[model samples]
Target chain A: MQIYLPIAEMSVSVLLILGMGMAVGFVSGLFGIGGGFLMTPLLIFLGIPPAVAVATQSAQIVASSTTSALAAWRRRALDVKLAGVLLIGGLMGTALGVWFFAAARRAGQLELVIVISYVTLFSVIGGLMLKESIKEFWSTRKGAVRPPRRGGQHPAYMRLPLRVRFYRSKIYVSALPVLGLSLSIGFAGAVLGIGGGFILVPALLYLFRVPTAVVVGTSQFQILWTTLAALVLHAVANQAVDAVLALLLIIGGVFGAQFGARAGRNLRADLFRLLLALLILAVGVRFAVELVVRPTEPFSLVVSEMRE
Target chain B: MRFGLALLLCLLAAGPAGAETLVASLSTSQVRITSNYTGSQIVVFGAIERDAQTVARAGPYQVVVTVRGPRQAVTVREKSRTGPVWINGPQQKFVQIPAYLGVFASAPIADIATPGQRGRLRIGLQASVNAPDITMDRGTEDDRFREALARLKIKELLFIEDERGTTFLTPSLFRTPVPLPVTAPPGDYEVDVTLFADGVLLARAGTSFEVIKTGFEQRLAEFSTEWAALYGLGTAAVALLFGWLATVIFRRD
Candidate 1:
């Protein structure tokens, strides 16, 4: 069953990587999140180097996002104009992120920074989602308001230049907020080597008060570009991409994304958040353990003289 | 005068009376080393031969090659193999060592050496081995020894295995015997080959090679050119800020 991959230079069957991609892609589609957060760690566990896994995962995200975004767009759920504005910010943020990433590498603290950021962000976000889901579950049992909507006036601080009205979401928000959110997600995407759809989906749903229907589509739209940009940058700068591994994951992810998008329609907002939170916490803890624990023996490889 | 004549006659009788002529040759005298972002493996080949019958018994020799330059020294060794193999019909028979094809060892390089400089190294050849088996038919003991041999790493095992029995070492005919990087620092190095028979050193030989550096700065310039995109993006961020600021300042009420 072993096949030697030309790019990876390792004996790994395509089927095995595809199966892993399908599982991760399913979750990504269902939750409107990029599965890079989970897939990268899993690849590393399977002995792929961290840099290769991240680069390959970025390529896989393109497949997953395109498949899911198509479905959400067909449902009349995408806000194209808004997503465009966000992309402008995302592109700028990604540039800054790469510079920061290179600086961190030179400082020899890249791993520590990535580990700490993942744990802190996931812990806070996951805890909030779990609490909200529990409250929503109890309220539903008591036959409380079905899909409760906020009634208070929107915050004034959110106002800025380039005000745009989104008719479907029934809101007029400044482009500045959208741009700022995109930049933040873009920075996260670049540093963590993820698609940043997880953060974008939640921000659109809650902070921008975009309808849940439009959030998935718009987030995917922005994520697609961001992931592509990151992939190109990583490839050019670090030569980190492994095309063989990326193709293996994409084949399964494309199909899984479709099913996930379909299931996403039925899931409640609080429940989806809850699942995301739990996944983030689990991955965070695993990363923490790796940083804390040291291996028994340290081995070094000796490089012989190179032949002309 | 009689004592002096006796001494001269004794010296003449003992010197070069029954010396065995052995020659060591490689396939190639020069090897080029290139920069590798990832690790690479290189092969070295050579052989040794003795004059017919003059070499009554030869074996268990060590070949050592040292890479010299930049305060770092790398050495490679080939150890002799001795064990039992299961033959036809479940019978265990000890195989004789092959004589034509000698030892082959591969070394993996994880990092590229600083290249573009000519360096010299020495290759030394010597004979060394453990005591031979005492029993005529050590069946179970030979099995145990084989098992132990299997557990040893590549560095521990010296002989190359094939369908035939073990043979005496032979010179490798490959074009490049050593893997040298283009960025290798300039220095002198040596290669040593030794022949041993039953733990006794019989003959030794050595050779040398040099590493030279060339066109290093030009390569660095190309690297900087490719990396300019990162710098371009950083400076453009300020332009983006200014555009945003202009939009805010020139907004229509």
Candidate 2:
């Protein structure tokens, strides 16, 4: 059951890796999240080198995002124009992210940055989701008049710049902020080896007032491109992408995605958000505890490039 | 014929009288690292070949066997809690740290030889690593860093030391088995067998083996290193293709 990963230079159990992929893929499908927030930590815990884990996880994200996004597209849930603009910004961010990643790696701070970013982002995002979902649940129970306009209702902000219409989401917003938002998301995705869907989905819903149905598809589209950029950058710059490990993950991920997308349709929005928030919080707390607790072994090792 | 005889006699006169000799061989010299290679076991068997000094003449024999992989540089860092978070603190850079090391001795390493002798021969973990390049002068801090490196390597199962790892079939013949984990770096590895008798060095023998990647695994590693840009493009293209294929095949109306 053990397989040797050439790039990672380690032997790992086949079933264990597959199971990890399936679990993460399922989450990806269920919530339209890239699942990197969970998968990257799990891979690191399983002894995969941090660089290889991050780079390889991006490949897996590419596969799962495609699977789920295609399904959404078939259902006419995607805002093609909006996703395209996001893709352009994402590519720009990817370039910057790759440069930053290389610098951090050379300084031996890549792992620390990854852990800190995950803890900070997950806690903030999770806290917001939890609060919002609780209020939404109560509002529905009380049958109160729901706010029809959320993100698109900002009249003053909408008046400031050249507006572009997103026909699918039924909004006229300035392309500048949309481009800026995607740049940040893309930067995060490349650097963190994530789809950035956790942030993207919520941003689309609250910031742009994108329809929930369109949000998932559009984020998936952006995720696919951003992760592809990350995959290429890591492979070229670090040579850390383990092809065998990525294949194993994709095998499990592709199958799990279908079932996840199907099941997601049956879940209530408030309940789904609550579950996602809890999951994110769990990961954040685990990271925070690791940072606070004294390590069993205070010493660590790194192989430096051999002098010629 | 007369010149040959004189030359032989001259060589013999210059050589030590009744010197004990050692001969060794590995079960296999080349370890082929295939795609499914998780690890490998190499059986190192050697014998103390006696010439003028018979087995009975010399004291009971002892053998110490060690296999060292290619040398490389490594950085060791220590982490300490800063406020609510743990961060890397002091760091040391060490050159000539072997990527892999396995030492097996028939008897306790301490019992085999004197500390000075061990250090001279680079026999054990403590004696093997060269002095690290520590910029700051902190007494005993260098030793602490070196020890930490050994401990961390041991925890990873990369560096191993077994006092009774070598088993003797006969008084002069011995065998030791070393398991090379998948994490073992691929390179030329030198195997050294030192023969000892009553804490006195008898003879020494050395041989080398290679751990190399083969087939697709070899080619892939090479391509990634040699033509990284192409490799990156290929990896991205393949991943994207696979994603597209999955989407198309699993498409639902």
TM-score of chain A of each: 0.88, 0.88
C-alpha-based local distance difference test score of model 1 = 0.53
Using Cα atoms, each model's DockQ against the true complex is: 0.04, 0.53
True contacts kept of 1: 0.01
The digit string of per-residue lDDT tens for model 1 on A1-308 reads: 44333333333656788888888878888877878888987887665656667766877777677666666666768788888888999888888888899999898667557767876776766666667768877988898876555664677745767788877566788888888888987887788777777778777776887887788888877776667566666666755566556766776776667668778888887777667667766766665554455433222112232222
Worst 10 residues of 2 chain B by lDDT: B130-139
- Candidate 1: Cα lDDT at A260: 80
lDDT of 2 by residue, B1-253 (tens): 7534643453354345236778999999999887778889999999877785443544578889989988877888888776678878778877778888999999999998888667667788878854333223444578778889899888878899999999999877889998898888888899988877777676778999998888888888888888887887787776666667777787764
Show the lowest summed lDDT stretch of 10 residues, model 2 chain A: A151-160
Residue B250 lDDT in model 1?
29
lDDT string for model 1 (B114-225, tens) is 1110011111101111113211344554443333322221222222222111223333221223433222333344444433333333444455543322243223223324
Best by lDDT: 2
Clashing pairs in 2: none
Return the lDDT, model 2, position A218. Answer: 84
lDDT of 2 by residue, A149-237 (tens): 66545756555587898898888888888888888877876677666788888887777777777887888777877777778878889
Q: Give the Å shift of residue B44 in candidate 1.
A: 11
